[model samples]
Target: MFKNRYLYIFLHIIMWLGYTALPVLNAIQRDTSKPQTNPYTNPYYWAYVSFSSILLFYLHSEYLFPKVYKQKPIRYFILLILVIAILLVGRYSARINFVGNDINQTLFYINSFIQYLYIFGISASYSFFTDYQKQQSTKRDNEHERLKSELSFLRSQISPHFMFNLLNSLVALNRKKSNLVEPVLLKMSDLLRYMLYEKDDKQISLDNEVKYLQNYIDLQKLRFGDYVDIDFNVKVPTFSKNIEPMLLIPFVENAFKHGVGMIEKPIIRVELQTIENQLLFIVTNKFSNDVQEIKDGASGIGLTNVKRRLELLYPEQHSLKVQQKDNFYTTELKLNLRQVA
Candidate 1:
């Protein structure tokens, strides 16, 4: 695309130069005494001269014509008188004389008139183009705002669904008189508070997000215990940037819910790191290969919601990949932090 612009400019410049020099070259090369086929000595010079004159006329029409129109016929006559004065000036100018004896003056009037005409035409065209561009930009901005609003709504729905499920689990454990249930509930409450309050903003500190994830993982460990081997490694940085709320939790929840909960000897691994203006998250889980036993063809609402949020919030600034083989399910999300900042 860039190459095309440069190529256009180069061709335009060459054409203009050729037009200006052609008349002079031809006049000097051929008989000056005999009548020339083309009277203008320099077509390129006339082109530029015409272009400039027309541009000026367009500006004058925009700014000056309004005042002139207030007086009706008097203003109209003045405009005609101005044209005659311009013609007389052209008839005497030596610059025009060099280009074509007396005919040079006539050519000057014709060229100047054409230039003014073009100036009006181009000015109208430019005004229309600018208005069109602004309208297009506004439409795009409206679409983006709508997408963000939808993402926020989805995130709001996901948080409640997660809380409802966790509470249900805690209720079951409580009825059984399980000793571990109380502490997990307390931790869940704290995490829920964070999500409900702190995450309402467009961004949250990375440190806070990681802390919540860790707490959530610990709660899961209390429930799953040794039946699941969960490995989580997130090296916290001294300073933190911000990220969208509840964006990564769905993947973690899905991992435990579908992968570990269904398999006898399940393993879930997660790794996260941030460097400069980039954040990377990787999660992999081992699941049973038995297709028939894989309950209801897991269409994860959380996963779908997170993917849509990522696309709306980040667009070209983020990359998300999901892979599922016979026994392993993997998801990697990379986001550009610079945009949020």
Candidate 2:
């Protein structure tokens, strides 16, 4: 409520000034044939009224309005009428008894009621507006926190899925006693370090993301060696840009996960190109009809996670297309880099 302290203070000053000046101005405008008995001349009367008004304003605003009215409106209205009546009676009785003034009882009651009404209206309106704004702010904060948690869970899914596949490759190399095991472990170490440390950031240098993808591709190359045909190409201009970490790797991993083993003469093609403030990523692979679709467990979870992340993070800034025709599965992603965070 006090986010803009100066504005809050300014508005409060203006309200109080108006509250103090209006009744005095009205008294000056009225016919005062008996100048000696003019109520405006009595500073004590004005002080009592001002103090009582401020007290009632805060009572209704800070306590009664929200806790009582919002929960039980009928009860609140009943209590408000009772409070107003008591205050009016008290003020009229005090004025007649203590002041020793011949003031009209009915007129005093009417004027007192009107003044308290004005105070109640002003305080209630201000309280309601500020409360509504606070509720909206709280709602936005909760949504932001939920998004962060969901993104964390999705990224968590990707790391373990990638690691499980790499570990499987390592096991295969160990059984075959392949000489490329050392290099594969080195590449895996770099990939793991990058994922563990750098992936926590909302954005990473486009250069680093490309290098991570290259490391994964090289590891896959060692795993397959001469058995499968692979074509990986990246063409990025000498420019500086940031991309969501691990955003593009799912498509490449999906290609390798479902595009080999069961298939004869398997082929995987991954290409990335950047033109100005736009990026294009395409991954295509050949699959065997005998193999199940990549919609089970780890494969399905990875794809779903990335798709949701893209929707949340990029929304209108990116487009994705996945198509399977005959034995080939292809995924094409286009992203607008201008809105990168």
CA lDDT of every candidate: 0.71, 0.84
- Deviation in angstroms for 135 in model 1? 1.7
* lDDT, candidate 1, 213-258, per-residue tens: 8888898888777878999998646436778877888889888777
Q: Which stretches of candidate 2 lie over 4 Å from their true place?
A: 1-3, 23-47, 68-83, 89-103, 175-177, 275-278, 288-296, 336-341
lDDT tens per residue, model 2, 1-63: 577898977987898778876776677667566533656545666666776788788888887
TM-score of each: 0.63, 0.80
Q: Which candidate number maximizes TM-score? A: 2
State which candidate has the highest lDDT: 2
TM-score of 1: 0.63
